[model samples]
Target: MTSIKIEHVVHEKCRIGESPVWEEKEETLLFVDITGQKVCRWNPKTNQVVSVSVDAPIGSVALRKSGGYVVALGTRFASLNWEDHSTSTIATVDEDKPNNRFNDGKVDPQGRFFAGTMSQEIRPAVVERNQGSLFTLFANHSVVKNFDQVDISNGLDWSLDHKTFFYIDSLSYAVDAFDYDVNTAKISNRRHLYKLEKDEGIPDGMCTDAEGKLWVACYSGGRVIRIDPETGKRIQTVKFPVDNTTSCCFGGKDYSEMYVTTATNGMDEAKLAQQPQAGGIFKITGLGVNGIPPYSFAG
Candidate 1:
């Protein structure tokens, strides 16, 4: 196994830090504080952090081709202005399932935004029920449902060839692969890629590396494990000082650095003392791997 170096980069201690997106153009990291209702940017060069407040809880954010950002805010898809810190409605979804809200998501190679909703029960703790659905936002601002009965729609990425779609429904405690069509933004033939052991914790946000392997963040497991998608076995493990590793992404000049996010939502004072770096952003290096550039929302 290779020795990995993990450092706590941002120490703000967000309520629920998730969705770490690397902005290649600006050379900064953009992440969302779900319960804090804010979008933040961290510049590695100067160690400066800039945050924009949103009206509602934000699930995830992706770079927009036209300009600014496309966000999964609450139950609606909206456009965020990078400079003025303003947002405009793009589309609304899941009106019938009022108990649900958008969760983790990512952009496709063809510029479509893929996101999903999880039950509001995600707060405090998740209920033993599946009432969420996955959705895709086309460039025309139209939203389409892909599937439902998801307990917590999280972690999404595409294969190196763009033929396989990798996903995780946290409650399922497993990773799934699907045949994906980039041109039509449709996914089919879902199959289990791998299942996490009981001690590995629930799988949260994940992304693929340049090598086509998956790096998954474990919510209560306190570590990030690298898995070989082809053989469905563990390749490496990166342990964190905190147990609530929410999400992660590759950034830095050469895309060799992995930025991870953690949360402090359910931590009590005693547990918080055990992990003072909880709810902060972390950077990991020395893994000897590069990452794929994140796709932007063409819409």
Candidate 2:
């Protein structure tokens, strides 16, 4: 087994830090503070952190080929000029469900952006269930509904061959797979890849390594588990000091380093004192594994 060490990335911290992405060109890390309404960039080399404020709660962000970012802004999909903090709408949904907002998201191999919505009532548990849906935003400025009846739609990644898509709906407490058609950007053959036991916390955002192993963040379980998706078995577990490990992604010059985000949401003063680093960014290394670069939105 490989050894690992975790370190804290000191910053002002976030109320709920999530959705970490690596910008290869700049050699910097990008992430979002869901409830804090900002997207931040951290440079490990200079130890500099900068951020831009968004009007609404920013769920996630992916780099856009068109010279900006595509973000999940509350009830709409919008283009954000991170440099100037300007935004324009791409598409909107969940008008009927006033309490719904976009959650976790990513760009697929085809350059299409995929993001999901969930009820805003989520705290310790899902207050409203099955009211969320997964949405796709194409470069042509068109929106399509892929699936619905989802609660707290989160964590998404594709396989090495681009033939399989992995997803997680937090309430389900499991990782699921779908047969993917990269050219058409369609997914099918839905099946349960693996389910976490009750002791394991709800699964949140996840990423896959170059070796195709799934690394899942356990929200209340205080650890990230590496699973071999093919065998549907657990391979390793990396514990965290905080219980709210929200999301993770692989980055760094060679994609060998892992960056993780945590949250302070729903934690009381007493709970916060115990895990003082709950809302800070974390870096893990020495895993002896490498990861893939995130796809950018073609639009």
Candidate 3:
């Protein structure tokens, strides 16, 4: 197995940087600053950086097929107006449960938006166990609860063949898979695909290559791992110096380069002094695996 090195590309130390979606049409990298409550776009071609603040903490973002983006705004899923930074909620969940917020999210091949939720307060815990749920945004603009009891839902990706889903329960340090139904947008046959020991750090955001291998980010491990989901075998481990790698995705013209995002949210001053490049974007080239294009919002 070959290891990859990371080069610091963005300077801002995001509290938490996750969910990266490559917008092919715009040729831009779209991501979210969760604790910063904003959506950011990076244009490498012009060295342009644009960020727009939202009312609530934004979790994840996905490009829409209809020409906009679907945003997870803590408690709701909405459509964003890139021009004015305006948002309109497409669906809301647990309106009565104010202590929950949306976490990780992605669009399936069928164009449905799937997002997960988590309790807001880590201490003085907001909700009882089993409250967090995975939700689906339908064509009629309605939200349906798909599953529950998720703890800090993080990475989410589907296999290239569209037959399997890979997800991470960050707090559990485990990666799981489910038999995915592309047509019905249902997931079943849940099975444990991989698990990270506490020493390896929590599993965060992830993506799948064209070969169907899953590339998962190690939140506190400071590395990204490429694994064979079927056999649960680790094929490669890409290391980063910092200890807060948040998420990664395959981008670039050929989709062979892996773009990674990191965070410095909970780092101590001493640790920050040692790894100053903790919260920055990175790119690793020459990885043999290629990523499939992300699905656009069809609504």
Candidate 3 at 2: error in angstroms?
9.1
Question: For model 1, which pairs clash?
Answer: none
Can you list the residue pairs that collide in candidate 3?
Answer: 64-297, 65-296, 65-297, 74-102
Q: Model 1, which residues run further than 4 Å from truth?
A: 122-125
Winning candidate number (lDDT):
1
Q: Mind giving the per-residue lDDT tens digits that candidate 2 earns over 1-299?
A: 66798999846468878889999989999999998999998999999988999888888999998777889989899998877789899889988989988999999988999999998865654559999999989989798889999988899999999999999999999999999999988889899998998877999999999999999999998889998999999898999998988899999979999999998889999999898898888999999999999999998
Candidate 2 at residue 92, lDDT?
Answer: 90
Model 1 Cα lDDT, one tens digit per residue, 1-299: 56778899998799889999999989999999998999999999989999999998899999999989999999999999989999999999988877677889899999999999987764544754788889999999888999999989999999999999999999999999999998898899999998999989989999999999999999989889899999999998888889999898999979999999999998899999999999999999898998989999998
Task: Give me the displacement of residue 241 in model 1, in angstroms.
Answer: 0.7
Ranking by lDDT: 1, 2, 3
- RMSD vs true structure, all candidates: 1.2, 1.1, 2.1
lDDT of 3 by residue, 76-110 (tens): 99999999889998888978778888888998888
Candidate 1, overall lDDT?
0.91
Kindly give the stretch of ten consecutive residues in candidate 1 with the minimal lDDT sum.
120-129
